[model samples]
Target: MSRIPDLPGVISSDEIVASAEHLAGLQTDSGMIPWWPGGHCDAWNHVESAMALDVAGLHREAERAYEWLADIQRPDGSWHNYYLPDGDRDMAVEDDKVDTNVVAYIATGVWHHWKCTSDRSFVDNLWPTVERALDHVLSLRKDDGLVLWAVEADGTRRWDYALLTGSSSIQHALRCGAAVGLATGSPRPDWVDAADRMCSLIANEPLAFQPKTRWAMDWYYPVLTGAIEGEAAKIRLADGWPTFSMEGLGIRCVSDEPWITASETAEASLAYASIGEFATATDLLRWTRSHRCPDGSYLTGLVYPDKVVFPEGETSSYTAAAVVLAADAIAGASPGSDLFVRSSLRPS
Candidate 1:
């Protein structure tokens, strides 16, 4: 099995391995990966960390992470927004909100693992989990074809809004879910239809989703998720270039914010690669190295101009995972690398 390879004159392979190890070390005995020690964990970020482990050739640890997810998944196939490492409440007010995108991302993660290891048995084992999660997510789809952002703790749905970034992510997850279905000979035409409709809204009708113009993720997620493509994807990136990108630094988390985030920068790099702009992508990934810590983990983001660490000066497993995944995509080191670059999720 191929692992993350070295990017000559850029980041070293040893550094990539160390970053993966850093993420793995963050995994608790329950196989959950918190943002940092004593930090809370979320489903989406946990899967991101697991994918990084797979990219680093730590299949055993990665599988254990997935098993953790499967073991703890709610009966409805959704996970709460926050969890403590020790499975205890760290905060007084627990967030019981269930995010549709968070639930849907297991499909992407499971499919990614199968791609990396070519493990059919593993895919088969995970198929039911993927199906149930997607079912929950797709159930949140509105008549306008966009999935609701979240289900509130009161059991009321956030039907009045849909997020561009979240919906874009769910579209990718739906396709991956459908692909998993097809691979297992249990095709889900419903998921395909939902994904196609969601893609149409994202590509043509920008107003369909809630206005989050300030966030960089909103600008690039359609491209990153393969919903926007060709000249349109290029134009999207070009349109938002000045607002989100920082030359020789990294992409900002929000347009009006001076915080440069490693995860957003790394994700933007993948979006660039999706549009065949490898040079631009490579530079973005190279720039993220500045956020790396001595222990090989990556900080969440840096407040610009002052160059100070923001958000409590913490390093995140997801941020380190994003860097590792971006490096893999740029180096073409794994089959899973093409997940971002290609439109494999597009409905046939």
Candidate 2:
């Protein structure tokens, strides 16, 4: 028998529809899912929100997003980190190509959605985009299995730093890709090995440099991305409950201070469930609900008064993805059931 979903209360169909409707408004005709109604576009947020739409049974919106990504993909298969409402590039790295290593790895989610609905056309249309993106990213892999943060077409430093987050996400994308290859009878060993190396590296050694930030994503993403597994993964979860986690609003981006944000919080909460911590996952999901906005958008951060930063009022596609992803975890959709993370672990 299928397990019953334990969603927050009896959220009316109307409420879910309203939330979905608000999400629909965020979608531009160009197919990009902006953060707020008129906020900047980001690759990370795009894939994250697409995954959310997939889980919600909104395949068309999600497909549109992938198409948007494909249309804007650089010749080398990379994308800038950000863009404007007019589709004009903004805040791009020096190379104008993004290191979106974490962002590009969302193929796992895409393939997972494909498996659920048996949508061959979605797979056919997106296969090329996924392939090219992976090909570009795989070129960045280092001998140690860690990818350079970002390299320009001319080969210059973008992020110029190795991030544990990037490695973990790549690992996830590779795994998801491998799953797709197997299902589609197109298994690629190179991709799987690359993902394996990334996971092995992170598990054996700490690669993420921002240790000072009290962000919980650093603590849990390793496992969530499949870098650590079995007893080790479980142990990491037990050890990290206090190390990087904040009590209420969710995990901070790092351990440096008290900086809490919705996306990271949701990501961390989902991470908890990734390792089978249902109790904590349930709590974090509840906390996230309290922050839900009237129009179904979510708050970005809580680093107020002390952090002299304008609280961006717009809710983001990534933020929405984080929220829905966390809810899916609470509803028993975990890494075991996660296809997005799996395909993300695959090669192009």
Candidate 3:
């Protein structure tokens, strides 16, 4: 099977490589993948970009990106919310908090790389990091099984309320972490149970999470993370479609805005595909072509009506990563293609 993803007329393997290369180019020598040239690097998006590199057959670069994470991981297995290219905590944004979802995402990235390469040694090496990270995240899980969004840098201050988007993502990561553990001969049944609880909370206890109804991520992430699936997932998408999607454009960053974001649209495509709605998924992936830049990097978002690029010429590595992942989900081009769609509770 092809390691690289393609969408025929929509996007070619070469175009996917170009986008992956664009993300690789943005990587600092230390292997940290920032959002943009000088933008902050969040753990979640940084891992996402690394996964994209692996999807495009850039395994060496992807490994380096993971090494960056290993190098900077805190003692408690958590990473600060944002980092600079120079490898320092970014206190300027969100006061350098440690987001539970951000810390948990390393498991997803590491698992994706393992699926692409089948490298047991790599998974073995990273297993401890993944273990610690997920353990740290689960340590903060509330009685309802939903994790709080973030904690202070010192792990002293807490955010108190849970978030639907972040907790949903954590649910996915926990399962991925369990998968990684099983691969390394170290199964984590507790993590698996935690994931199931989080999934239940996400699927049944909407009020448990802080209200982020305006954000597009809040609308699609549960489905994207596989916390809600089957007919329920389809119905959720249909219910949110009118509010989040823009015909012939892309999904909005916020329901109340006309601004269309590439990453959000790409992720929504993956969510739709996970539920067997390939036609809707393919169309969503196609819509992201509008954000494609000449250099294969994706513009962050576009303001509708006039279709002006917002953030003034911003092209983010994470945006390109999302597009690459979405294409993989739709095309089933690689072993890792089903990473988002497959059940993380089982072996890949």
Best candidate according to lDDT: 3
lDDT head-to-head 1 vs 2, winner: 1
After superposition on all CA atoms, what RMSD does each candidate show versus the true structure?
3.0, 5.0, 2.8
Per-prediction backbone clash count: 0, 31, 0
Model 2 misplaced regions, further than 4 Å: 1-6, 10-17, 87-95, 100-103, 157-160, 207-214, 303-314, 333-337, 340-348
Candidate 1 minimal-lDDT segment of 10 residues: 85-94
What TM-score does prediction 2 earn? Answer: 0.85
Q: In model 1, how large is the Cα lDDT of residue 172?
A: 92
Give the number of the best model, judged by TM-score: 3
Model 1 accuracy (lDDT, Cα)? 0.86
User: Model 2 over residues 33-126: C-alpha lDDT tens digits?
Assistant: 7777777777766777776666666778878877788777777777876676674423333334567474456566667567556777677667
Runs off by more than 4 Å, candidate 1: 87-93, 343-348
Q: All candidates' TM-scores?
A: 0.95, 0.85, 0.95
CA lDDT of 277 in candidate 3?
A: 79
Q: TM-score winner between 1 and 2, please give it.
A: 1
Superposed by TM-score, candidate 2 places the C-alpha of residue 86 at a distance from the truth, in angstroms, of 1.6
Error of model 3, residue 237, in angstroms: 0.3
> Model 1: clashing residue pairs?
none
